[model samples]
Target: MPEVLFPLDSSKPFTDQEKIGHNRWHPDIPPVATIKPGTTFRADCREWFDGAINNDDSADDIRDAPLNKVHALAGPFAVEGAEPGDLLIVDIVDLGPIPQEEGSLAGQGWGYTGIFAQNNGGGFLTEQFPDAYKAVWDFQGSECTSRHIPHVKFTGIHHPGLMGTAPSAELLKKWNKREGDLIATDPHRVPALALPPEPDGAILGSLSGAEFDRVASEAARTAPPRENGGNQDIKNLTKGSRVFYPVFVPGGHLSVGDLHFSQGDGEITFCGAIEMGGYIDLHVDIIKGGMEKYGVSENAIFMPGRGGPVYSEWLAFSGTSVTLEGEQRYLDSQLAYQRAILHAIDYLTKFGYTPEQAYLLLGAAPIEGRFSGVVDIPNSCATVYLPTEIFDFDIRPGADGPTQIDPGMGAPRSANPNL
Candidate 1:
């Protein structure tokens, strides 16, 4: 057991923890702890929603989930002697759901996947799934099963969904400016184009009064991936992964949170991954001046870990950049991926799964989504590969057709005021 630097009590609210963590990102938020390079330690993480979501069959919590208080991170633990222009080498040693615990809190032998309502924070397929839905999954060792989405069981590919070094004051200003400008384009859009710094639910480490007021007003939200690597949601960052983050401040203020029990390629649903609160063991080292030494000046460079479940056989579905309305968009990989996902959902319906159940399964399973073509003229092609083993029956198309499964009560749905 490495020294537990940032401990968390699963029973308490995130704000009630002894060492409080921040939800927004800013340079002056202060470090909870400091450590020399080449040190190994453990940190406990709260679920992104800080336990606001419940372990129940209703999707009401998902519909009204507080987007302001999110990504309850465990650190900004300063790496001793690291400075701007250097590279922070983070090796994810080990991590998992709360060990030996079983209770209402997520990651205590269970977790959930959700589809955000279009009125709230919509997801990649928000147009199709405009309402909120949820699927609760019970974990058993490395595998899990969901009653909301029956007839499916799969091994998890657990990993942290958000990790990054703090952005400098200059970089932070740029983020605010760029994002603010974008929001100005469609300020009233549901789910908005981007989230601005709101001081309502901010929990900055120790700052208060005027300082807290200033930072909270300027700090960036931890939703989208930035140059600082905030909320990239990469599913392959499992154990043994190596991430080289560009250190933009002294001491290399690194923070991490939003652990996922499992997630597909693109966490398509807003709360796509099997969200959990867990502990992560990390080994930190610095490359001194490796940022410029490797010609990687911005963003993060990572090597996917050798960990996670592997499946060789897949039933693949591909789609071009044509909208559900049959309009073609040129070179839109995102739209292509969206169409591919919809195609997968359509195919799964043949097996008796409601579209929401299939969508939740794709978001939580170890499915692989890849970009197959982009150079083509009027359309790009994307492919989603579903592991055949995860399903109890054959998923591949054949003469016998799809095998039906009892989808149970189906995923819980919420009343969406927006729709």
Candidate 2:
């Protein structure tokens, strides 16, 4: 075990922890600690919702999930001698769920994948799944099994959902301006387009009173992926991956949280991924002026590791830009992917899975989503691939039809009252 720089108590609230972390991204939140360039450290992370979400059979927690306080990040661990224009190299050495504990808190031998209700925060398929749903999964070694769903077991690709270097004051201002401008367009929309900085539930490390107020009001919410790399949610960032983040502030304030035991591409559900609270062992180094050296300035870039679960045969589904209602859009890759996922859900229903269970499965399972065609005319073609081995029976089409599996209780659902 490496030095536990930021230790979290699963029994305590995130705010009550000894070493507090900020949910929002701001340069002035201050670093919890400083480390040299070649240091390997361990940081315990709280699940995004802390302990608010229970390991239960209700989707009410998912329905009423706290959207304001999120992505309870571990730190803005200042790297000694790092400066603006430098590139911060982060290597994901290892990570997993909380060890040797089993209880209510997520990652204590279990975790969850949730579908956020439309009124809260709509997901990729929110229009199709307007209500909230949840699937609790139990961990056995490296694999997880869900009672809410059935007949599926697979290895998880453990990784952090949120990790980044802090933005400089100027860069932070840019984020607020753009996101605020976008929000101004649809300020009253349910699950607003972009979240603005809220002062209500901010935990800015050791800052207090007036300073906290100023920082919280101006800080960017940790929902969207920004130049500083807040929540990119790339499932490929498993162990042995190396991410290069552009340093926009002195000391390169690197922070990480929102760990996931497993996630498909896109994290289609808003609360997608087998959300967990876990520890990450990271090795950090600096590339002096490497941002300009690598011709990268804004977004973080990375070389994904090859340690993810391997499945040679995949049952794939494809979709075009046409919407479920038959409305066609031009070169809409995003819409194409959505249709592909919806098609997968529809197909899974043949096996007796409720749409919610199938949707949750697509979000948590290591399904591969890709663009099969984008250059052609009015429609982009997207495809989603599911590993055949994860399921007990054959999912392919033949003279023998789809095998029916018990969906158990199905995914627990809560209808949106606002609807």
Candidate 3:
């Protein structure tokens, strides 16, 4: 059995505030616990929102939830045998559905999938889906059922979207300077935030009270993937994978967060996949000079495809765009690709698709996307592939909104009186 360092008491409801882990990735935040290498431990990770998000939440909830508080990580668990110049091999032993009895969420058995509907500044696809949306999923270990959406059902994978070790003070400083240069490239960017004086009450596990005794610079923001590997968002990092990332800090203070039940390739409509808090089993080891051997400047990870769904067949759409003079711009390529998704949305609407239906279809379907290439100079192209087998009926959209979907679509939901 794995060592229960940060154990979530399965006996009670998982709503307790005291048991949650720290959120920030700053070296100064200090380690919550320490362990020797080759040891496996269960990390009780908080949701990306900490614990504030809910089934009843609105788009305003997402837009208003704590912008800077982003991913509520579990721990900076200092591996005893790890040190600088070594590679921290984090073995993803297992992730979970966050047993309904002890998980953070109240509604779904395990998780929630959603889209950010901020009217102002939001995701890359915010303009298209300009409303708050969510679909709570009731997970049964491997398969998940949803009441909010009924047109689909698929097996869920326990994938931890974010995991990484900490960076040294020197490496942290270097990372900040380089990213700052990139931000400087865009003159309109505002001054960076060190540690926000306070985290909005909506998110749990945030740095507050004595936790702010030392605040690392804005460089410690948990979003970017740096040398120490914070948030890579690699979907295939499920079970049985060995992550080989450079260790910059002493003890390789490793942290893990942003636990996802399941997610598609391009989380096109952001906010997240089956967002839930649960236990994670990790077998961590340290490799000396592994970075030099692998020759990875950025963090390198290997994910096995065994534990999740893989693409077999897809109905794909391609987007092509070019300037009048034949010069291809990437922004146009992106726009065209997104437009093709909208086209798929329009096409599926004939079979009765709501905005949420279209969104969930994109999520549940095995959609594959690629920038393809920009080699033509004048024309660049991108492709969005949709799994044709997912739609059992003929190719047409209709009025099958949430309330009208076929009962055969998914497992029975105890919620949703409208159905």
- Which candidate leads the pack in lDDT? 1
Candidate 3 per-residue lDDT over residues 241-358, each given as its tens digit: 7788777778777878788777665666665466777778998888887777777645666656467765466766676774334555655677666656666666665555665657
- State the local distance difference test value for candidate 3: 0.62
Where does candidate 1 have its weakest 10-residue lDDT segment?
410-419
Q: Over all chains combined, what TM-score does candidate 2 have?
A: 0.98
Q: Evaluate all candidate structures by whole-model CA lDDT and list the values in order.
A: 0.92, 0.92, 0.62
TM-score of 3: 0.80
lDDT, candidate 1, 32-98, per-residue tens:
9999999999999988998888989899999999998887999889999999999999999999998
| Residue 104 displacement (Å), model 3 | 6.6
Q: What's the CA error at residue 68 for candidate 3, in Å?
A: 2.7
Total clashes in model 3, counting residue pairs 3 or more apart in sequence or in different chains: 11
Clashing pairs in 1: none
- Candidate 1: where are CA atoms >4 Å away? 416-419
How many clashes in each structure? 0, 0, 11
Task: After the best TM-score superposition of candidate 2, give how far the Cα of residue 55 lies from its true spot, in angstroms.
Answer: 0.9
What is the Cα-based lDDT of residue 396 in candidate 3?
Answer: 35
RMSD of each: 1.0, 1.0, 5.9
Looking at model 1, residue 175 earns an lDDT score of 94
